[model samples]
Target: MKKLFLGFCLLVGIATKAQTVADQPFLQDSADKFSLKEGEGNVNLLQVGSDRNKAIKVLSSQGLMLLYEKNLRQDVQYRPLLDMNIVALTEYQGQFVYLTEKAVLSNAWAGKLYINHGIEAPKAMGMGPDFLTLVAGEGNFAIFKNNQEVWRSSIESLNPISVQYDPNSGQFLLLTAEGLYQVDSVLKTAKKVFDGSDLTAFSLFEDTIVLGTTNGIQLLDRKTFTLNKLDQKLPWTEITSVNNIRGNLWFGSTKGAFKLREDGKYDYYASKRWLVDDHVADIAEGPDGSVLVLTQKGMSKIDFEPMTLAQKAEYFQEIQRLRHIRYGFTSDLAMRTPGDLSTGYFHDTDNDGLWTSMYLAGELFRYAVTKSEDAKQNAYEAFEAMERLTALPDLKGFPARSFERDGYEVGLHANGFSEEWRQQWEKENGRIWQLSDDELWRWKSTTSSDESCGHFFVYALFAELAPDKEWRDRAIHQIKIEMDHIMDNDWYLMDWNGKPTAWGKWNPEYVNSFPINVGDRRLNSTLILSFLQTAYHFTKDKKYKKGAEKLIKKYGYDENANRPATVIGFVEGEDLSNKWNHSDDEMYFLTIPGFVNYSFTEEQKAAHFNAAKSHWEVERSEKNPLWNYLFALSGGENIDSEESAWWLREFPMDLIDWKIDNDHRKDLTKIAPNFRSQTYTEVLPGDERTLHLHNGAYRNNGGSDGKREYAPYIYLLPYWAGRYVEAISAPQAE
Candidate 1:
């Protein structure tokens, strides 16, 4: 008995650890944390001390200067050393050696400049602690020792491009058109370590020597000197410069600069993130491990710091709070124009309730996982806003797109429109109504089928999870009214004009008319099933279940639900169904968890689960976190958990819709655009594509002029759902 009890305890311990792992945070937000100290002109050279407190020295067109921070502040302080056109600054044999366009000066920082005129200003130079090597013209080379010439030689066959001193071997490695050559101070002999042509630059490391060649970066073994090409994996082939700082390899190319992490993956920084220009001229390291990138335009310092998962969650939460206060309540705007979050000038999309419903679902999951009062309150507020949308219109359960004050203009269009323009817009936007005989209120009409999906989705969630009995009853009441209106109108959402809205028709006549392979047929059939199931789950009404069964038996709706997965790929001649509708994808996936969770029978659950799995298989290449989270919730696959985490991490923290232009980027791997999907091998989703509702993220072009700030719910839904399903672990406490 004691042994059995011990075994049970062991199992309990293992289960607890597993749950903790899932609860631990999986992503964090990271930005360039280093502040750049701009220079007057192009930076020629950068040097720093080994100590953390030491200041950095920079040589530029403005002259030599000391860059340091007085205290922990955002700005940097500079101290001038000499206001001269200095090209290079280096420490040689315990003295500061300064190179100019005309002459070489020593001890310039000590107010006593000793000039060396034996060798004219060389095109390329290399400095060691005790010796200096200069390359003049193409291959004419000379060595200097303490302001005196030691040796001079010329290898006219090899065109010398750059020079570097190896501290480990105490010798100069010269990069020439032939290969890398090691030369001694006497210049009597030169030994070729590697046979390589077109070497632009080179850096020596403990185990390998990295060469910047025309093809790409080449890694050569220190002893054997064999070449290993990295061009296939690199974003660009033309390697211009290379630097090794504390094991992190920084490569500069004609396209952009990238740092190779210890894990062997490359982190690319371009497009105004860490560079002022794509052409990287040189790279240096500061005392505190910051990277100094010198481009053709100027210099930029980037502090590469890894963010923790807890920080990411916190950032999203804060953004969610701000967006909710600004735009999530009342009539939720579909999208905000770039940099206009405060004034609420946004696009009043047709699916306001649908967007808010997804956000409400996220809050519901948050409440379920954390039991935080704030989560419950937020869910209640969004529910109230959605509930009011149904009450604004008099057509029984017909919910409006959104609502506004009676005096407010129909669309509330942007400024600078003429009075004549408002008259024509009134027909489209002006649908005012009075709910009561005495009171006046207006709401936008012409509701669609997608709105019904969102309505049922949130109503089902509220019915199942609302902490208050009154709120649960309200949810059920709302569901009954909406379902009754749809059924009584012959499975169509009739608008205020007594005509079915543009997309609200789901009757057999309309649904069955589409070809068997069409998306509308599958989508309408699947939406009706989810709607009926949700109504039955909340009301326990036999009529709702009977309605669903009739569709499956009569119109082959069950077969139609299975057909959506096959049509996920592009089909020739069927442009409407072939072009992936991301909005419909959003509506489809959001309905799955509720439909499956509240399913009435084992058979029903099986059908819904299989349909969801099939769709997920098609969407796996897109790597959408929300879809992956929903699939995992339905017990499809958890392998996407890590991928879901990656999506959340890749989401930009800057929610503004800034114009992103990738056309000029040479590092991007462009593929042929197709109807199936657009993809790039080099750029991530946020960088290459616009923010959209569906898997359109893989469609790589768009965001040229501006981007729209998506509602925070878009991110919150997947995050909280991942946590609720144990696909993402809670972050460990800091």
Candidate 2:
């Protein structure tokens, strides 16, 4: 992946005509990883009882613990019963009650401690209306009322797993693996109501008794005791816990937690994107319309907030301005420890120019549509970053990939090239690091097509969309100089050694040499043509126009550029040709707007538009906002804004590169690996998968240890692009 960074790392419905209404609020999911602060919450919130309350009581390895919302979703605080070894906990009459091996206590009454009626080592407990029940084993049970022992039972046939109290029925039900049993108030005797096995969880859904078995769900009429079984249609079959919060059915399984929607669909929350671990221990309702799920590792709160796309843009804009920008460039935050922001330090990448340009493009688009001063200032600052890149290397027209202060030159980061061979390769590729003339900085050499593509793309955006005339002039000038350098050098980016960098070649010699199945032929032809066309559009220079037309008419680059990406297949002997080059996709989409918008004639626009349409047809399945919006701007219709909105709303607020694995999911329909490496029948939603940027939405699984936090450009670029094209509207006021 080279500049694409192959760091051993790495989907929703469509909207066909939903963007017509401007400033409308759309649903967005905000994930609360329930990030643990030291000494604040329990290591594991293993809820053991059947108490269905917003205040969850549990038995942690640290002893007894009570989970509470402390600082919203950022910090879920837990109070542990450190001094006492408590076994079970429950809620009775709106107060927390607890049981130890020896006795029972209530946080509501400090001076009152009741004996457990010889139900030692209690593991399960429940309370309802005026009754408290504790179970130690299959046959041992103790019932208490108002701090007094009421009933004790020894029934050998009962193997109690959970205890639930139905408020409507005024009855306490004890659930065992064998069946459901009802306990009467008078005898405190247990009678079998339903005959079933492998039951794991129980909850009362209004007047109905909800039973969770290993395979499916069973609902019983609280008064009639009649049963209704539900089909095993769930994200995961093995149900570990079930709870009804405000009439909504929520279930926790071994894989993830899901909410049963009214339409029989489930809103699944899994992976590090939603929870700390997929193994959900328990789930409960939390403060502010949030759903709290306790996992094998820790807790997570899925917060549902109503906001417009504009509000979301502001949120991400603030995040980028706060933590990601470095020297006006969108930079990745490197973390010394996994998932720790305190250890994060902003760092540069080889494609800093490319990424900054994308961020800059989004800002310019934002300024054009919203006229926000902050957006304008953002564009100006990013434009300055692009300017600094051109000047840093001290090369007249060739920009450095990135630069660092003196003595910060690490070994070469060339993907296929080796460190041991750095010296031998330098002779051919030129010095990978060159000392700045001032002796205070070092610039990375071998500037790539990624940087080139990014420079031109943003330069065109700033020239066309930036509100300020002075800024537009500066961008237009840079566009001319950069294109002049590339064209004058025979369509190759020359390093200090006067040789083309390995990947900076866009000449017909290099491009046309590739076979028809190879992507570089089409991509390279499109790029150089776009560069020349954009240069001519602003500069109106005959050389730029002649250069673009020469490529199209003389070398037949028009044909090369119009082929669909589906034509790209495995070219057995070549390295890059062995797989689809995703970086090339970014290069093409970013360059196409410039190419199509600046066409020399109407016929040319029609032809270039054909090229864009072909690529979009291939990419349509991904439902990428940036790509789709770019297509809409290219005069295509029926581009789904719903898919665009779904992508935007489902994107997680968390940007940390946490390790994720979806390969083990049983709910997915697995497919044999294809050219794109697609593994699932359908792509999962944005919130459920890893933060893959443009490279993914196709890959099913990837792992990272919070070593790097991604820049929000991935979200911002598409959002503003969608906005500029009117594919997405401004946020509506509340």
Candidate 3:
């Protein structure tokens, strides 16, 4: 009995060891904590801080008028004797307020008092105990505090910009177009801090006062009044404003938003969208070091829990592991169970589309490449099941629509628009169009039929990885069909129902009309490469290379000639001239470098690689990581020292940052305190349509192009670029 017990214990110990080995690679786990709440108005301060209980808010209601107070457990916490509402809130010893209309200054703890004003109209305002100042456009000025008039002094160029206070040192500072001034609390006087320093704003923290100008931020030791230049280089950033949260300070710059770490190092942050025009108005730290933010349209949050050194090491190992994982599949296209048939949690029932198949295929490939055998097996089964489903006779033409029982195609359903503009269209005449809820499928047909090229690429990728002839043949046939039907002689992929020629002729309800025929060349090129690469693996044909060459030539290699010659620069906000749809190009660029199987001269390969580089160079920035990820992938495969160094320098893990809670704006630089990228022009200010790449921009007017937006394509960009880590951030190979 003792011998038998010892043997069983040994078996259990081995099993335990195996399980530990499996779990070791899986790291970087995160769970969703909170759903965002909606708010309105010129929310000046949205404090989502370390103390989660303190959900205090302050916002402007009537331009200059303000409303503020923290939500209390029982009753409203009122400011004593302050009848008129507060316009702005700041901290000196505690929370202080700047009231509009009555010219009253008050504190949350201290009682309120009216300040004497010398001028009839106050254009710019700032405060200091026993002192208050107002500027009226030109050199006109007023100074008062503590309900008493004080001596006022002004020069020709003192255009007051911003004011801030340092509590620990008991000092008040004001910024103007000419220079910075130190306000004496006792004497009620203003003195210049430095000469020839035109100021924009000042950032105030616990013991830090940072002065911002066209040059850069100037840090001052509040206690000693010692000056230290934070950034000496002019145009290092075009700082619009500065914010304080917890022990850190943040800068909203023209290039992007950055967070100053406790150690005084800088890191960028965005809400994971495009905020080219909008400024990161304010930040509120939340539970577990998470931050709540307010931008122009709504609020957004980000949780940053510091990773330990061990975690960092694990992350690097996973990165190396991604290169080693090999992928394969069976040659037989036949299957016992349909790949689309699954009892999984995320199953789709809509039979018409290949959304579910593409999703599963992408997920499986991602997992498989990361060395997850279980996920690999699952992915294989998914593809096999899809093959079986495709074999169904009635569903053959890769029909645009599919029905479970009747096996019939459902025509497009439309909801009539309230406006007369869209009502003229036949598709938009009457009923509301609702897509199927449950559908397990893959894209196949290249005709006017609604199909996903994603399906073909997914199958082709599997075939290439595994060396399957049958899969390779199917991919080739599909590629030919795609080329003949949608791809024009110029290498541009036609949008809307396989129409290879002019816009709106083939399909009326297609996307953008202008160069709409060009579409996302990245996607077209990626899919073509996938087919060419896989076909080469099986047949070793130079014809595939010839075909790819033709496409490349027509499209100008990187599809630059096809895509609009513009890239949105979000220095202040998203520059609309640059926000062209390029997800397709992004995907193509990512997979182009992996075309090692194809027969090509070194010159040809170099040309293709350079084309991909052009796309990356133009689009790459802090806000957009899809481009960065693709750039890194291409760099990794090519093994070019310069490219690798470039990626490491610019697109580092800690370096990629996004703004939070910006409404869908194309340009982020133009909009202030509304991290969303918005477009602004001298003619029509704050036009989101011209600026952003969303539903707001592309509309279904009576024009050739119907109602559609490019934003959805933006989200799918990561898949084609092979930037899988950014998608799931999975540390494990699986």
Give RMSD to native, each candidate. Answer: 6.8, 6.4, 14.7
Which residue pairs show collisions in model 2?
11-684, 11-685, 15-643, 23-730, 23-732
Residue 613 miss distance in model 1 (angstroms): 1.5
Report the CA-based lDDT of candidate 2 relative to the real structure. 0.74
Which should have the higher TM-score, number 2 or number 3?
2
The residue-by-residue lDDT of candidate 3 on 1-734, one tens digit each, is: 11111122233221110001111222121212121224433334322222223433433332221212222111134434234544444433334445454564544434555564544334445655444444232454555554666556665665666555555546566667566677665575667775546556666776667776666777776665577556743213556567676667766654445666454445544322323124444444544555544454433444454443224433433332232111121111111232211211111122223432333444444453455554455455545545443343222223222222222222222121244533343243332122232443222222221133444445544544333456546644544443333333233333223323221122212222223234332334444554454444445656656666664665443343224323322333323223444434333443443432232455544555565566555443322434444344333222222322222222222111122232322222243422222232211211111222111222211111112111112222233223232222233443
Best by TM-score: 2
> What is residue 643's positional error in candidate 1, in angstroms?
2.4
TM-score of each: 0.78, 0.87, 0.44
Q: Which rank order by TM-score, best down to worst? A: 2, 1, 3
- Candidate 2, residue 56: how far the Cα is off, in Å: 7.0
Among these predictions, the greatest lDDT belongs to 2
User: What's model 2's TM-score?
Assistant: 0.87
lDDT per residue for candidate 1 within 310-337, as digits (tens), equals 4665666676666544234523333434
Residue range with the least summed lDDT across 10 consecutive positions in model 2: 1-10
**Backbone steric clashes in candidate 1, count:** 9
Indicate the TM-score of model 3.
0.44
